[model samples]
Target: MAATIGTETGAVLVNPAARNRAAAGLRSIVLPLGLALFVLVAWQTYVTVANIPSVILPSPISIAKYIVARYDILLIHAIPTTVESAVGFLLALALGVLLAILITYSEVAREALYPNLVFFQLIPKIALAPLFIIWLGIGSTSRIAFSVFIAFFPVVIATTAGFLSVDKGILRLCRSLTATEWQVFTSVRFPSALPHIFSGMKIAITLAIIGVIIGEFITAQAGLGYLIIFATARADTEVSMAAIVVLCICGLLLYGLVAVAEMIANRFYSADSR
Candidate 1:
């Protein structure tokens, strides 16, 4: 009888522990979704009760309807923006990595360029969009170039910081092993600095989208930015909101791609280490 009681008590405690673990797993997915639904419901109720003008503040339902009705138009404008942003992001990544390598490998280059790089980063980048328009014209060229310009700094700074952050002892060990400069960098410095580099790349990806949007605002004849500007001019808040929602989706998709790349790279390095 005592043994049976002990087994029953253990089962009771273990069941709750398993239940609690299950609840914890569900919480991560449930909480955010619940909150978002609550906010949408509240927003819809408030707009209905207040009799708010759709032009001023469209409800979530109205925005959803607008998006569905105008999906084709939005897609047409979204493609150019996506292409320009992707191009700018890739260019910034290449230039940033190359410049960071130069700065890391050459003391003379670092001394000459690092200060200037920081200075440029400190300046208001948006103000330079017009200058790019003047140089590259009111075309996709200007938008892409401007986006690259704004996105380049974070990558360079982040990558340079990563390269410099590697342990000196590890570097010394590599050197003692008769590792060549290229081998040392590829095997030790580059791998170690990847986290920082990816950190910068994430920031650069977002900034690239912003840069392209700003360029479209200033001069583009196409793109989601143009759509937003056009809709706002007509006081079509629903359309503008729809465009913004689409833009947010694009940004998220781009950022997710970079994040996946980072995860894969990290996994590769982890496997190599083993």
Candidate 2:
């Protein structure tokens, strides 16, 4: 009877800890949402009180209404732009990682290519935008190329750093153990490099969006970038603001997706897992 009572008391104590953890998790989600709502309200109120002209700055309410009214139009352009960005970003990631691996394998290759990569990064991609347009025409291919150029640098540098930054001692030990080259890379270097690779990926993802938008700005028949230009030209500030808001939301969504991916990776492959 006494043991049964003790077990009940312990179970009761355990319940509150579990409940607290659940509540904390709930708060994590709710707090950010609440903060976003508060900021939106503040933005609308400020615009209203300041008597900001619709041509200069439309209120959140006005923008929201515009979004609702023109959802179909926005969807048509947004989808294609998003596809271009995604494709370009993935291409950049693949090429960057592959090059990084190759550079890691050969000191001569790294020495020869790294300087040229740096020079390429220094040359503004926009300066080449017109060239791409001429070469590829005002189409998806040109835009994707711009996106790849913008995103590729960071991924290449970050991934190369990740591979090179693997602890010397660990690498030496693997060598001493007569580990195969593949074994050394897979078992020691690759895992150690994942964080840096992910960091690069995050930067690349954001930059890829900007590149796509810039490409659209330069020459595109359709896209949010074109819509923004058109709306601004016509003084349709409501639609312009709505478009900007949608762009912001899209960027945030992409960043959030990366963050979630990182979290899942950490959960499964973290040091604790080993």
Candidate 3:
């Protein structure tokens, strides 16, 4: 009997590490997923239990069904907004990187413009969205310009930091080897700056989406923002919610794309996350 008891105790002790590892694996998966699942379940339950009108707050399932039913129309609106975001981001990338290079290369440029840049960043962008429409007219050009304005600052700040923060030792070695200014910048400074550029781009990408949507909200006839306005006027809550979901998905997709780009850059360049 004693021998049997000892065997059972040893078996229990031997399995504990395996049990712990299984528990950890389950936790790794479940912990993150659990919160989102809980939120969705709770949202559904609350709407059903309260007998809430769909006009007031449509259930998640209702919104999902509505999106499926109206996908053809939604796709029309989605394309314009996507185009605006992409164009704005591309412009921001070109201008922001150029500005960062200027600030790093020319002390005069930094001294003359950095203060104004900070002030420009501090001002509420939405308050000026209408002004942009007024100045540029109600078209894609104005919308793209507005979005670029919103995205440009983050890239400038982050990439400038990256350039400024490159290792002095590497810089000294470049100088010792009599590297040309362009060679030093291209080979050493730019590579070091990429991680920061990517960090800034991730932020700028999200801002670009918001800026494009805001520009559309200010003026436009054929985008997700316009769709929301039209639906709201008609008291079509389901359609409005469907448009909102599309906006959310678009934002997520943009951010994910930037993150993937960052990961790829990091892999190739061997960035040490500071």
Better model by lDDT, 2 or 3?
Answer: 3
| RMSD to true structure for each model, in Å | 4.0, 5.8, 4.0
- Worst 10 contiguous positions by lDDT, candidate 3: 265-274
lDDT of each: 0.94, 0.87, 0.92
Per-residue lDDT value at 214 in model 1: 97
Q: For candidate 3, write residues 31-103 as lDDT tens digits.
A: 9899989998999999999999998899999999989998999999999998899889989998999999999
Model 3 bad stretches (over 4 Å): 1-28, 271-274
- TM-scores for all predictions: 0.91, 0.83, 0.90
Using TM-score, rank the candidates from best to worst. 1, 3, 2
Error of 1 at 198 (Å): 0.8
Clashing pairs in model 2, backbone N/Cα/C closer than 3 A: none
lDDT of 2 at 238: 84
Give the Å error, residue 26, model 3: 4.6
- Candidate 2 stretches with Cα past 4 Å from truth are 1-39
Error of 3 at 80 (Å): 0.8
lDDT (tens digit, per residue) of candidate 2 on 156-274: 99999999999999988998999999998888788888898899999999988998888888888888887888888899888877777788777787778878888887886578863
Model 2 scores worst on lDDT over the 10 consecutive residues at: 265-274
